[model samples]
Target: MADPIPETADTALVPTLLGDVIPRVESAYVLGLPSPQILDLVLERSRSTTVLVATDEEASQLKDELPDAVELVTAGIAAFAQDRRSQPRELVLALGGLDGLLPPADTMPWQQRLAHVTALAQAGGTVIVGLGNDAPLMALGHAERIDWARADDDPTRPTSAAALAQALAAAGQPVTTVHGLYGDPVNPGAAVIDALATGSRDGSLPAQVVEHVIDQAGTASIPAPDVVAVAARSGQLSNLATQWVAVSGGRGRSVYWTVDDAVVWADQDGPGLDWVIGGDADTAAALPQRVPDTITVERTLLRHIARADLPAFRAVARQLGDWVRSSADAAESSEIRLDEVRVAGATLARGISLRHAPVTDAAPVAEDAPDVEREPDPSARQVSASEARLAQAWRRFATRFAHSGRRSAWPAIFGEEDLVQLWLTMSGVAPGTVAPEADAPAVAVPAVVDEASRLDILQDRVAALTDTLAARDEQLLIREARIRTLRQQALGAARNRDRAVKLAQDLRRSRTYRLANQMRRASLVAQPKTLVRGVARKLDGKVRALRRTR
Candidate 1:
């Protein structure tokens, strides 16, 4: 076993993540090598006493961190269960699961080890077991192939969440609920109870929320969102989760998921389920006091897309457009996202309000100004704040929509930019009114690539490249025309200079020129001052010519 490590910020939040499932009790016993932070949370939440059972290595590090008031037992599962001093407790937390508590020397079966742990909990008491799924979708392409010939591997261990639940039931503690833990198994960022996970209908609001939770927990190796969508529709998402937190004789919240750094959980005690945020004051304050009901505009649209129902999609699109136009504040309308807008019967209202830092506009530059090299400013635009915000929101939605892989009313040939223009028009915003700057940075969507979406993305890329090439071609044509005009002007000036030189030569050669020269000499002779000035000018010109020769 590795040395016990100190609790991290994420691990510290594990207690909060599992807080609903872990019941408050008078006395609690935590078995195995759980995180020190979890132990601390248990200690703090327990009313009277808390006991920790860990190996010698883990205990060495934990002893310094834990107080003397808590009893620390150092023994294997076999020895600990055989001890007569061991008594039933109100809460038994085996968060490390059976593998962590089992010693290599001990030959106890997995089922028996589970039974021993449950026996420590009193009747009607709560037992929370954290078990890793045998196979998770996130581990699909990354994990190494297992060798069937390995003799040391435990054969009797529970292979799936269902098997583990059954094992717990057989151990005299029937599971009350099984929460699907997402993200890291040690400290899951989100959890959904079995009731919600199994009961939510595919393409419904609750199902979409669960799908989003899995998407957040997914890694780069797997296209979690797309896989989760398909799996949720097929009713297999519960089995594909990374870890399962099974609870016996205790009730927990229906759902819990993290947004940004804050945790949001759905309260089941209320007449209708309502979400409450728990985190830092600032984060909590920024989020809505209550989350919208399950049926959201985004979910309804997605359902329509899945069925290829163009009329239904158009109806919802029209409603969204109408809502955007009717909003008293255009700035507020810009912040409203399809997912955040809830749908109840025929009524629609904005639900969650995500706090985005206000974007300050820079001083707009004149269009006819001379070209100069400078850094591009995103906020330097002629568009109003409302138009800019609307454009930005529309662009974001377009990018996400293209990558979503759902069937849209538009043709397959339509790219991301085309969809943006279409959607903008549909939302009562003119396509040409708010022109996106050519140099504006593209909005980045989640890196979830699947075969279904690959074609759409490639098509969009090709269309974008085509448009870019066309613009560049037009620019090149304008530059060529300008260059041609300059060349003609230079030629005309050269011809004019040649004609003036010839005329001067012809005039100097004519008899009239000699007469004019003599007249000029006569005039100079008549005025002495003029003659002196003329002589001086001639001398200066001669001197300048001499210097040039030198």
Candidate 2:
């Protein structure tokens, strides 16, 4: 195990990126071992009082160390995020033992958890982490790294301070002057507090450090690949790419891909790549080839910059300028003639000025070379009849109007079909309407011919009428004969009816008929009397039987 720093307030306060960033820190993520000194300084300096500890061990330790007024919770950052009992408060988290806390391969989950912690800290919270040496630096996101080296002296602090200063300067936040942290017997745990106190003692320690680093970084010519790697490690790749796009005169648009074992960079959604560099070689060898040597420094240098990528931009820009000069000299020594150039398959040439004659008569064109005809894009192609009509109308309207602007305005005046018909009418052409036929013309004829034709027609009509009259007369005669038969049948039926009535009257007046009616009436009256007498006799018999029984 490594020896710990001696228990003394006298710690050599080294000027570092984190130290420079500490005073301006409304929030922070100090990635190193849990420092009681640092925690005490943060709690004293920061406005937030709530300290959330991820592990039970940290929580137990904090409960004993922190003041009773400061609330300490053992809940993970995610749990605090879900709790809505009150408004979110700025938090102080003690994250330690990263190597044992999370497995190395579990990057995605680790990133997600870290992002959750970041979200929790969004409300003015600060996270102090104890990062292992093998910790994936990229997964930490854009947080200031504070190295917790036990050794009283560390060189990396100056280097980091320089980088931070240069980055900030490149982003247009220049430092005029700064103070260096090189005092013996300085408090490393209370680094921020010491910085502020030191600055107060000599007008501003951060300012002095920023100026010193900026001066160092501005003059130094570091390798471009080293700068890129540093930015990537610092989680500023996206910012770097954005700056690159902006520098290339692209509207913050770029795509990354591999071509011929080299990274091909191009405009967003463009037809082809603009710059190619990077293959099996490392970043240093590949970076110089990103742009052609002919491109000017002004054209390739980024104008728009993000604060996070400021350090990276400064490092890369300074190095690229030096590389460009060195590479240009090398390229001059081994220049190839146009005739010696080998164009790849499907290579496109545009406005290329040929310094020499045709390169060996343009080697025989391949028979398989496709005669490509571009199909119009769906969005660009005219697909609708309405659009076609609108286009046609626009052309016609342009022909008529003095101002071209009237074409768009004319549509509001007339509906579609109406507009077309109006144009047709205005052109002195009939608008697709069928006119009624005019009355026939009156013409005179020769009397003799007219008379002969009329007489022939009249004769034919008379003959047809005569035939029709004869047929009608025949039908009338048949009807008359039927009517005569029907009248005779009616008369015969009436005679039979009169005879039948007379016979019936004679029968009613006859004596036999009268006697039969009187006899029927007498039988009906006697039957009822007989029924009553039988019923009385039966009742009297029943009465005599009942008296005998008694």
Candidate 3:
């Protein structure tokens, strides 16, 4: 670890060391036909040597029941990768199954292939994986066999080694012409070249080869991902790794490839967490250790920036006069309201707002982004008569992009509008807008109407109880009145028996007295409290009866 202290400041020139990088091509596959068919086609088209690595189990099977005209090498992928150091390869094209070069099948998860690549990815080697169609291979996780729909969804999404080889070139990787590193492109190649055509300063493709050569680089053509900012806020880019660099840029913006030089800078970092790399000429050698006080990248300070991290890019413009601190432009999207902040689905209004928004800077967050909720664009607002109509039916537009659950569906029905109030209410987003007028949707909330809510059942029970209580009271009162009348008539009649002169009058009067007496008795007996007490007394009187019934 030596600083660049000008080795020699001669009359006019000073010498400097240029970095080195190696080219690597990785192909993602779909597992089945893509492995057996498309892979070979690409190899043949690219004019590279294709070797098949096979394990004992697969070799036994393939040797007996070979398919078509598939030519394969029978070593395990690990063994072959190790042997590359001994025999070496200019371009190692490894195919599938018995065709793989690695041997000893007890290891290697097929997908990661971690064991072999570790040793084989040196300056002398360039690795290329051939996948015919890995759809079935990847699909094996969900089902016993392959799923056609899911497998074929995107035929070319997997790594294409041919494309990768081109990407490495575009990335300014270390190796030169296929022959320069592997020594001779294909036949009778030497393990190392003791010959001519020195490579780039970094020992990549020879200056002659990469000087202006821009062919076959696919990822190189795409637009580079920009540094999107969220002010003080941040999130993890789940789509990529922790140490991410813009994969495509310059002539091959779309093309993504890794250079050995990039890895060197990343590994040399002395725990420079979230520090950015590559800022002006100063960042070239900025290792992390020197800036123990602040989170920093080597000289550049660009390497430390997190994918989702957003510290005000040039908040104070910490520079000397004419110098600007950051080169990244701010991401222009509007911010989520401080009140609407949500974390793990708890309405974090008062309790967690302080956590999300530290007082230092006002930055937006990118983690757990759902589609954005729309607010009136502050620029457009004038009170009008439509206020009434709008209140009655304010239609806030919502598309699939407005929520987190459905990022994939954004392409279809984009920019569509639905009632903002209804959508917010349905999804339970904070600060839900309500219907404009008092009468609007005043019946019941949608959640109440849902059959699963059990409102209907509760309402039925309430109605049944009301009817039973009302009817029972009425019936008991009538019974008491009838019994009283009968009792009064009997009493009057009995008294009149002594005198036959006014038979009907005495009978009537006696009946009235009997009825009144009966009515009083009936009232006492019919009382629910008295009936319950009598039942309890009877039970007490006949304990044996209760035991027998039991």
lDDT of each: 0.65, 0.34, 0.29
Q: Which stretch of 10 consecutive residues in model 3 shows the poorest summed lDDT?
A: 10-19
lDDT of 2 by residue, 1-550 (tens): 2322122222212222123223433433322124565566555555545655556776676667777755665554455545622443343233332222222233323333444434444332333222222111222332222233311232221122233234324433343222222111122211212112121211112222222222232322333223333543343322211000001000111222222222222221222223333222542242334332122221112211222234443443334323323334323312221111112222211111112122221224567766768675554533232222222332333333323122222323233344434433332324343111122121122234566667766776687689889999999999999999999999999999999999999999999999998997777578987756777899999999999999
Residue 99 accuracy (lDDT) in model 3: 21
Of 1 and 3, which scores higher on lDDT?
1
Best of the candidates, lDDT: 1
**Model 2 residue 483 distance off true place after TM-score fit, in angstroms:** 99
| Per-residue lDDT of candidate 1, residues 308-412 (tens digit) | 676787677666666555644333443666656766455555555333353343435678877768786665556555555545655666667777765665555
136: Cα error in model 2, Å: 10
TM-score of each: 0.66, 0.22, 0.23
Residue 48 C-alpha lDDT in model 3: 33
- For each of the candidates, give the backbone clash count: 0, 9, 78
lDDT of 1: 0.65
**lDDT order of candidates, top first:** 1, 2, 3
